[model samples]
Structure formats: C-alpha cells, structure tokens
Target: MESSLSFSLPETLVLPLKTQLISSGSVPRSPSKLPFHHNVSLTVSLTVGTPPQNVSMVIDTGSELSWLHCNKTATYPSAFDPTRSTSYGPIPCSSPTCTNRTQDFTIPASCDSNDFCHATLSYADASSSEGNLASDTFNMGSFDSLDMVFGCMHSVFSSNTDEDSKNTGLMGMNRGSLSFVSQMGFPKFSYCISGTDFSGLLLLGESNFTWMLPLNYTPLIQISTPLPYFDRVAYTVQLEGIKVSDKLLPIPKSVFEPDHTGAGQTMVDSGTQFTFLLGPAYTALRTEFLNQTTGVLRVLEDSNFVFQGAMDLCYRVPITQRVLPRLPTVSLVFRGAEMTVSYERVLYRVPGEERGNDSVHCLSFGNSDLLGVEAYVIGHHHQQNVWMEFDLENSRIGLAQVRCDLAGKRFGVAH
Candidate 1:
C-alpha cells in the first residue's frame, strides 16, 4: 500500500535560526511535574513488515522521531511505512499539527507550496536526512497504548558507534512545538538509564515519583553556537572554588567576565563524549595544577585527547584539594548566575585501562572544537544521578541533584 499523504518542502526559502526559535514559542503546554525516575526502562514495539515484527524501541527525549532498523524491503530504508501498519495517517502540510512538527533548514516556507511542514535536519556527526511533519500511532508497552503520532522521518541515517547503536534510531525531543511527547495526555515520562548498562526503558503514561508543571512556569532559551547540530542547553556559569593541591588559585577577571560573551553557550548534550573548556580558561586551570601533578603519563601519537604534543605526560592532581580550598566557597565566574558543581562530581577516576604507564592519566579538561561553538558542553559523561528537565511549556530546563532512591534497594538487595 502506498502512503496517500506526501509533504515536501519548497526549493528556495531560507529561514534563520532566530526565526525558527520564535516558532518554538507556539508549542503545546508541557506535561506537569516532570523529572520522574523509571525504576524500569520502557520499551517501544516496532512494527517492521506487513506481518508486524515487533522490535523493542527505546524512548528517548533527545530525539523526536521514532524509527527502527530493517531489511531493504523496508519503506524508505529509514522511514516507517504507514501502509504496512494500521496506526498511521496522512496529515496535510497545512494542518497546524503538521506545521508544529516540521522545520525548514536549507529552504524557506515562501519558496514552496508545502507550507514549511517539510524539513531536513542534520546531526553533529554530519549525518543528514529529509522528512515531513506527520504522525503515526505508536505502542508504549502493554500498559500505555495509544495513537502516539510523531515525525515520520524518511531517508534517515546516523553515525553508528560500537555494536548496539546500529539498530537504533533517534526519537527526537527537540521538535519545537511539534513535540509528540507533549501531545499525549500523559505529558511527563521518565527515561531512566543504568550506569554501564546499555539497556534502559521509557516510563510512559505516568509514574508516582514524577510530577508535571505548567508550561508558563519556567524560562528557556535556545542555545546558539558555531556548530548547529549539537542541540545544546545554555546555563549560567557559577564557579564555587578553584584549588591546586589544597591551595586556592585566584581567578582572573579577564578570563571570566560575563561580557566576553564570545565564550558561547554552556552545552548540555547527551551525545558528546567529554566536556571541553576554552583555551584561555584551560590555561588558567593548568597554571594552578602545575605543582599538583604527581607524575607524568606519556602521551601517544594519534591520541584521542589531542594534547599539545605527542608525548606529554599527564600529572595526577589530588581530588580533595580541588573540592575544598581554604576559602569558604570557590567562585566560578559564569555567564549569568554563579554556581558551583560538587567537587566529587567533577573529579573523575582515571579508567584502569588508561592509568599508570599506559598513555594519558590526566582527568583535566582539554581543548575541543565545541568550546568555540559555545561556552561549554556538559556531555553525557557528566550526566550522573542528576535529573534534567526540558520543559517546552515552561521554556526552562531544571536540573535537580538527585540520588537513586531505589539503586541499592532494587533487584532484591545486591547480595
């Protein structure tokens, strides 16, 4: 069966990111009391062929579209074929719902008759695709089943890493106003993941620990940077303290004045591998650690960290000193509000494989192209125990420092 509705974009319209951001203002109200934890991760039932092969799908807030891997016979290679399933429909581009889900990147709305409901989005890894703003009924486990329609992305592709990522596609959470997660009556759901555990679930419908808030409650701003694909969140910088081997390192004003807006956005991304700091900012930090580095770990050629030289040794800095200096509080000059993250949170234990006599041993921040884009990017590596909330309705994201209430207690006590 052929899909009856096909929404395509115009060939010549150009819209700026600022204009697109304004469009996001019209999105539906966000689910209330968000930030719920899923004791168990939820899974999606993917219908691949005419017979309906159910593949377990992951519910991700990081993506807005839902897709799965299949053979060549699969519709569009990257898209979900509506004809093969009983839960899809053809939504016209003129429809308000369609406009909400689609965006115009390389083209403009005026160039085509499709009303800008067709879009082409690209990811940081340079993967790109084209699709229309449409909806499809999705099954959320046996408990929460409904016609949850979302962007039916076509010709989609992404960079695969490791073995597990190949079969997975993204379910975007950043569809401006067209976000399907908000359309469902159950506005809030928990996306709980286990450390070192690839298997996680999407807690759809609702949970006891999760709470929903009004859309008008919080403030949110879209992050702007040199790199467009990294859909990042910007936060105010607040440095609580800076210490080198138990000694306080004085922070210079030239390095952190708010007006030097060139620092870019402090990125909150789940896709990136590590957090990067600017060259100037990194220099100031290194000055303090000069004495604290206990020993050196030889840097190898073609190192991922990209140190200045091929053979630079990374010195060890004691953890206790950075967290608690003589000063009552270590101030971090930031773009907006001054905030201090936990010392334990920043100090990472060197992976055993990369430790002593191996190659690099330093846990210090390094230079990354991402630094040029925005002030900082808080990658997935740093997202631990904290519950992050991206409320479209409220327009602001909330970060809560939380502990797993059921961590040690789950699975009948960890013998």
Candidate 2:
C-alpha cells in the first residue's frame, strides 16, 4: 500500500493534464505514488466522415464531449487524416453549448478566459483542434439499439508521424457523463476486447462476478485541479499467491516500495492499459521463475506479446515449470487471500504457427517498460467479466468475477 496527498478536482486542470500525460509526454510517477481513487474507463477511437473510417482511440467516460482527429489541407483522401482533423471554427458568443448553454461545467461564459466553453484539443506534437459538440452514433456487436452524441473538434491537431494521431477520437462512458448508454439509461452494458486472438468484456453497472468472487475496495481522493477527464475510482491490489516450479513464495509488506512515501495508494487503472509490478516484487518473481525452470527455458524476447499499450521486459516459460498440464495455474496472494490464475488469463498466447514446443504458445503478461507512468495497469484484456466497483467516497475498489455463455448471457464459469 502507498500514500498520496489528495487534490481537489478543478475545471482548469484539463489542458495541462492532456498536454503532459495523455497526448505525447509521459508523466513520471512511481506506481505506488498515485491516489487509490484515480481510475476511469472510457471507449475511444477515431472514424472518417459520413461513412465513418476506422480509427483507434482510448474511450474515456471522464469526458463529456467526443472528438476525432482531422485535417485542414486534406483533399479527397480515402479516410480520416490526423494531419488534417476537425478545426475549431470560431463560434459567436451566442452559441448554445458554449455561452448560452447551462453553466454546469467549468466552461465559463466569457470567451476571453482560457476556461471559456470552447472545444480545443491539443497533441504533444504541437497539433491542436478546435470544434464543437455533436451527436455521434455507437454500435457494439448486436447491441446497437442506443444513440449518443460526441464532439467534432473541427480543427484537430496532430502530426503525420506522431503515434497519437493514429486514432479518430475517444468515446465517453463515465458514470455521470452523457453517452449513448448513459442517455438510454441502460441498466447494464459491457465492452468486449480481444488481443490478436482472444476477447473479454468490460461490464458496467452490473455483472455476475459480484456474487461469485470475494472482493475488496480501497479509498477515493479528490482532484483539486480540473481536467476534462476527472472521474475516478479507488483500487486495492492484493497478492493472492506466488509460485515458482511448484514452490510457493510468500511476499511480505516490506516488498512494497513507493516513491513518495505515501501510504495505501496502490491503484488499478484501466485508462493506463498496462500492468506494472514494483522493482522488489518483480525481481523476486523473476528470480523465482528462472531458478525453478532453469531447464527447458527458452530465452525469447518479451516483445512477442503485443496488446496495444502493454509494457515490455516480459518473458515466457514452459508449463513444465508448474505441476498442472492443461493451463499453468499461477496463484497470486492478494489481501492475504490466494487467487489462482490460469495461463490463459495472464500469459500471452502464441499461435500454433509461432509455437516452438508442445504448448500452443507462450504466456501473455504485462511489460516492465511502463515504469514511471503506471506501476500496475490491469489492462482491458485480463479483466474480462470482472465487475469492478469504483467507489469515490469510500476509497476502495471491489472486483466480482462473472461467467458468460455463447449467447452472452449470465452463466457459471467458462468451463
């Protein structure tokens, strides 16, 4: 557990946070230096005009307005151009969403102030966007009976070579925001994602996991500085079990190391989309894996497993390291209780074409390269059917496992 000072959520902090962390720059903070309450999940991606084009993005419920990358000099191109995205056309002071609109948000009526309710988005490469809010359509599989609106930042700023320019725009799915699901007041919704092969769901509002698995929630913190995406939740990371070559290793509280000396600040973040392990904890685990399965170990590059924004410095070992054969069950000890995870859950799967031995593929896990930005990122892939309760006032996070059938209905375990 780590500790971090709480900051009040303000409206003006959005620009700086986007400029520094979300866009291009990486914010350097130890994984243990964050408030347990700062977590949110959103659906984001980009698309072209009329017949929408396919663009990747990070969905954010924390934001109300939705926008995609655009361009100014673009002619009759095949698809959306990050180099020429939506540009913010100057709206007169009489505009509804900006001035005459309700003052519920931080956007002020005065256009002179930077906080004026104007839609201007910027990227780290110096590209910027200026646009307005517009209703956008959304459809996930057959669950398409919903309608919502998003922002069209007429002036989108992004470089052709910059990685951020790759996506169209973000979808907002925050608890208090206006999304298709939120507007329709859908009592239940789920976001499903698969890597190169497998898939999982991000269930919102309710799930079967709540009753099946025991869960615990951490505390919440207030954001003093205002940012466009300010909604957050608390998380408690517990180690259920650790094993190496059929040997169990006990992790003590002393293994925990936080940079700021803050207390009880460990958090699980979906926005980050990476899993980060502390230095001491990682070192111990790595040493154990190597020491036990020194035989039949293949020294392959960790880069083999790719799940978008996953970290690096990961490797794979054979199921022979453990006693189980079907799927190597790796047990984790979280909050004093032991939780066993099969290889399919955490390990990267290598297709038969890529397999070198008797196993289907290697285990997929988090990369270690995402050190300063996030310590432990429980990405969208591994957290499927897991109902996560983000309680701001209570300062805790609760997880409930769920089972779904081919019909996507609630059921027992997968097997």
Candidate 3:
C-alpha cells in the first residue's frame, strides 16, 4: 500500500508562516589523514530553473527525493538547466506519482525512451545518483520560493563520483510524500547544528516563542520499518539510557529495541557524519567511554601517537590543543528528554577548519559493529550543539539548547 497526496494552501496564501533561516554552507571533507572533520557538509542555497538557477544544495535529512544536478554541458558542479525552466514539469509514465514511486521503488527502471520518471539515489558513502523527474521553481531560502517536486539530476549512479565528487543536489527532508517537508506545508521542521560553524539554521514552521522553557519532546522511531515500500524513511529514536559521568550505562534497554528486520535500530542521521552504536550499544559505549577517558583523557598524540580508524573514543591532544577537553557527562536518554553532550560537542572541529593542522579531537562516536550488523547510526556527531524539531504533524521529536538565528529569527508555527 504505497500512497501519496498532500496539497492545501490558502491560509490567506501561506499566513504567518514566515521564518526562513535555511543558511547552511560547510564542506570540509578530507576523509583521512585525520584532521578528521570527516566531511562536515550541509549546503543550501537553491534557486533552480527559469530565470532563477542559483544552486548550492545538500541539506538532506537522509533524502526523500529533491534533486537538481542537471549536467549543463558537463562540468557537473551545480549544473541545472532543466531546459531553462519556465516552471519545468516532465514526469510522464502516466504520472501516478510516476507509477507510484516506480512501482514501489527498488528503482531500477531508469525510465527512458520518453516515459520520463527516473531515479537512483544510493549512499552509505558509496555515493550515487541518476536523473530525470522534474517539476521546478524551488527557491526556499531568503523568505520564499515554491512549486516543488525535484530531481533533474543528469546522471552518475557511480563510477566513484568524479567532477569534484558531485553534489549540487538533494534537499529531501524525509518522511516522504515527495518530501521537502511534504511539499512545504511543514507540519514541523527545525535545525540548528553548528558543528562549530558553517553557520547553520533550518527551521520551517512552528514556534511562536513566548517561552519559559517548553521544548523537550521525543518520539520519532521509524527505523525503516521492515524495509520495503521503498525503504520506510527512517528517523528512528527511542534510545532510553546512556549517561556517562551522570552514570547509567548498563545498556540493554533491549539493546535499543528495533527488530522489524533492521537490527536493534537507531537513526538520527543528518546525512551521517559519525556516531553509530549497536553491538550491544557499541560495546556498552566503547566500554563506558574508555572507562571514563583513560589517563584522564588526552589523545591528539604526537609523542605516543595512536590513531585507530572508525572512531570509538579517540582523545589525543597537544600540537597545541585545538579544543575539546572537558568530558564526563554525556547524556542521550530521550524518553522525557536528555541531551547534555559536550566534549566540544562530542569532538567536532570547525575551530580554524583544520587542513592537516592535525592534532586529533576524535571521539565522535562510532562502531556500527564495524558495519557487520547490530545497527545504530546517530551521525552529525550526535547532532552537535543540539536543537532539532521534526514534529511532522505531531509525530513527535523536539529538542533544545538554542542559539540559531542566522538572520531569520524563528519561533511561531507549532500548531
């Protein structure tokens, strides 16, 4: 039973819904040699097609669809002509939302010879993409721009992604129905994650701010349910226990319960940067965070040098400490609310963006059982600097620890 539909606007044209903050632009990927920002990315600034073409996208809540990498003559970097959009459209195959998401998406038809509707999106770092499927006019940054239904991608399902490793595409904020917060009527959407600074803030609907606190809510848990009708759009949560120095890690809240065939599920994924646990909650949180930072923490090694890959609890410091030393008290509980987190927000570096200015602030948390199973994937370094609000018509998921207003102060849209 795959379905889709949601379109209703006329609250006097979009009433009181004015809080735009989409400002994101941080890209530091070097992947190894370990100054390890691991790929701190989050770009957004689109104005695609017809008299608009301003592309810079990559704000993906693990994607649902949104795309635009049209190839233009082929240098691939931000190309989007879509036939010079005059409101572009192209979706044929008798559009039943393109044969119901390509017959329940295992998406393998690539639709050509003129039936339109084609797609391929894959990534777990393998990186992929394939094109065709349009509908234009997506501006959404400086106050407004609409008429969505994206993906005009010219193709690159993978050949090791060249052309500067592509990506002038993807905006999908999942929980599908052709996402973008289900076509811009945001039943709830929020973002605030300053991995120190790429300058972030993405709230779109909800919050009138007459505040006295009130913002700690929880309940998202989907875990790609039994994985099929096109992989169930995961956002999962329900962790319930993990407080270090505040003590509480006998982990086994049924190992974070998630077994509809997706292994003890866990996914908060802001396009996964680092933070994965499951293998009994990453061996009881890497053996209780290395038993509370062995040797009282400090591992930016130069003298004793130790750089184990896939982050477990790295600490090494001193090439002139690049910040991050104030551990003990890690919190993640979430049933009623608990975020604590801070070892420089679990070790993320933006302090002078590190270009081999290496020292090591690792401890961004990992161990998805080394990708063999027992899943968990939090990422965005467990959402550094907090503040997320995905409400989706009250499906539940709110958080706090404010201070994100790139220029468009938000608060007013929580109904």
Candidate 4:
C-alpha cells in the first residue's frame, strides 16, 4: 500500500552568525505526519515515551542513530526523564538489534555493566554522545503512535561551543539500519526548503509530485565497503563538473571521483549549513568566481576575513545598496542532472558583522581541505527553494525548483 504524510515548518529562526556557522550540523511510514522548524539547523518537535515528553530534535541525514538527552544536566536542563515513562524499555546487550545492527555507527556498540546496549556515536567535528539503546512510543502530528528505537543519551560532549544546548537531541534519517526512515520501512521521502522564509514542507512515504514542478533525477551512488573518513551509508552522488555562469571550469573529471581510500565522493547532506568541495575543485571554482566578479564586487583581502576558517572569498557591500548588482550564476553538474544556483544563493550575508553602513558578505562555498576530508558536500544553504526527494527503493534523487512557501500551502500544511 502507498503511504504518505505531510507537515509544515515554522518561520525562520535566525541565529547569531558564529552560532550558525558552528552548528553547521528524519522519517516515517504509514502516512504519519509531523511539523518541523528552521532554526540554524532543521528541527522537529515530537512527544516520546508514555504520557508523552515533548523534545526538540535536529534532523540530520548524515547520521544514523536517533537519540535524546535522557537526564537533566547543568547543560541540558530540559532533558527527557525516562523514569516518568512506563513504556521506556532499554534494549539488552544480547539483543541482535544492539549487537548485529550497529555497523553503521561510527563507534561499535558495547555492553554496559548492567547488560544494556551501550551506544557511542561520534561526528566529524569530534562531538560525541554516549548512552543506552532504548525504545519508546513516539507521537508527532497525525502520525500514529509506535514504539521506536532511539538512544537514551546520558552524556554529550563537544569540542566547540555549546550551540546545541537549545536542542534536545537529533533525528537520523540516513540509510543505516537504525535510522528513523530505515526502521519505518519508508520507501521515499521529500522536502521543500524555502529561501525567503523559514516556512517549509516535509513529506514522507510515497510522494505524488504530479502537481508540483517537473523534476530531474540523478542516480544515488553506493559504496560496498567502508572507508576511513567516508560515510558509506550517506546519500552519495557523482558530481560531473561545475559551471560558473555559462562557462565550465577547467577541472579534471577525476578530481570528483573517490580515490583508493574512498574520498572525494559527493554527498547531499541537510545536516551541513554550507556547501563544501574538494581542494582542487574548490580552488578552480573560487578562481573562476573571482575572475568573473573582479570589478562588480569589492573583495575583502584582510587575513582575518575568513569565516570559520573554511570560507575565504569575502566581499564588502555598502549598506546604501539595497540590492546587490547582477552576479554570475553557478551550476553544479551532476550525473544526468544539474542544479543552477542564483547569485543571491551563492553569497551569504555575514550576520553580526555589519560595521555601520558597510557589511561583509562571503561566498557560500567552502573548501573541505580544512576539515581534512576529500569529499564534496551539498549543504542546506545551496538547497534552498528546491524540492529534494530521496527515493531509497529506487536508489535515485529527484530535484526540482519551487517556491517552498506556496508548496507548503499546496500540501495543506502551511504554518
């Protein structure tokens, strides 16, 4: 049977530029629905456990296991109290779900002293979460209540700032066995992100795009074996080339392919806020972009103008200019498809960096070399106002351009 669900996202919740840059860090079946919000990260509010304890979770496609702050702490004051829920059941260490199905996690699962399934999840940024695997009844929007597996996190650690304090945990929507989408057996899911507003729409299960804009498809890449610094379970794709306006950059196609170590593969990750490319491709694109805008925009050459030590192409915009001058467009050429980005989406206005009537704007694309990864990532900032569909069954991704605000209304989920 074909199942589907629709939900809305709250208005844009703008955050500090530093927090937004640092936090640069979900699915159903049977027609269940839930709404989400656009904070620095995409978040969804849902009730878990018996009698329902509401918690906000960040939606991360790059991750697998879902987790929540289980106990109150000096940092997480509003954590979920498992003692108050009767339906909360921790998985046993002997269970196959804990021992056999944790290969997708960054760290292997282990047995705690009490024989409970101990889970340790790690991220690329060195942040980590440790807890026990547990199940509880989850309710969201029109979705029916069902017992879902998630991490009852007892501890969280991060090397960066405490930017995630406002969020309870994270919802993983990747292709791993423990992810929400994989656990629910959802065949397909879609989301439309708005560029102008925070209001967006997320749909799960079988989606009907007949009434929406036409879509272009690209095959999803699959890696059979695991490699260090590369996520095999991510939504990987082949990036053929790149075009600055109508001119394709002079970059070798081999620069986009993964090396023997499985690096350089491109992934569409909603968890990251900005796009990143490998060193070679990034350098070529950056040089071409600068050449095209040589006279149009004033370049910032100060050594301290870098953003998060990733984005370096900074520009100075006068406050008197209400509208930016016509800038070149960028197109990401993919296997059998391409996505063209407008000038506005290509440059990001640095928040909290405005000095009097002058403001600092930087190119949204960053170099992945700083992260010590040889992979390309298409982040949420580049996906604004686009309809992105992940078809797990067919192993393909669909892309289309549409006004997300209107698309939300059309789905009858306008917030």
lDDT of 2 by residue, 1-415 (tens): 1112132211110000111113111233221111011112233322333333454344543333445544433421222443342332334445564554323333433443434345554421244556545443443322331234445555554543333443455544444334433454434333333332222333433433443445544333434343343223223354434664366766666554232333223344454333445545555665665554445345456455443333332345454554323434454445533334444565544433233443333334443443333233344444544545543224344554444222122321121
lDDT of each: 0.38, 0.39, 0.59, 0.80
Question: What TM-score would each prediction reach against the true structure?
Answer: 0.56, 0.50, 0.32, 0.91
lDDT agreement of model 1 with the native: 0.38
Winner by TM-score: 4
lDDT of 3 at 139: 51
**Model 2 lowest lDDT segment of ten:** 11-20
Q: Which regions in candidate 1 have their CA more than 4 angstroms from the true location?
A: 1-81, 98-117, 142-144, 161-165, 185-263, 282-291, 296-366, 370-372, 389-415
| Candidate 1 TM-score to native | 0.56
On the 0 to 100 scale, the lDDT of residue 316 in model 2 is 50
Q: Distance from true position, residue 52, model 2, in Å?
A: 11
**Compared with the true structure, what per-residue lDDT tens digits does model 4 show for residues 1-415?**
3333243322221111111211212322123345576756777767888888878788788889999999788887658889999999999999999988898787899999999999999876578999999999887555557678999999898544355777788899899988988876678778777887767867766666578877889999987877885688899999999999999998998999898888888999888888999888989999999999999999987777778678999898997888889899999999977888899889988888875678989999999998776689998888888888898989999998888888777666635
2 against 3, candidate with superior lDDT: 3
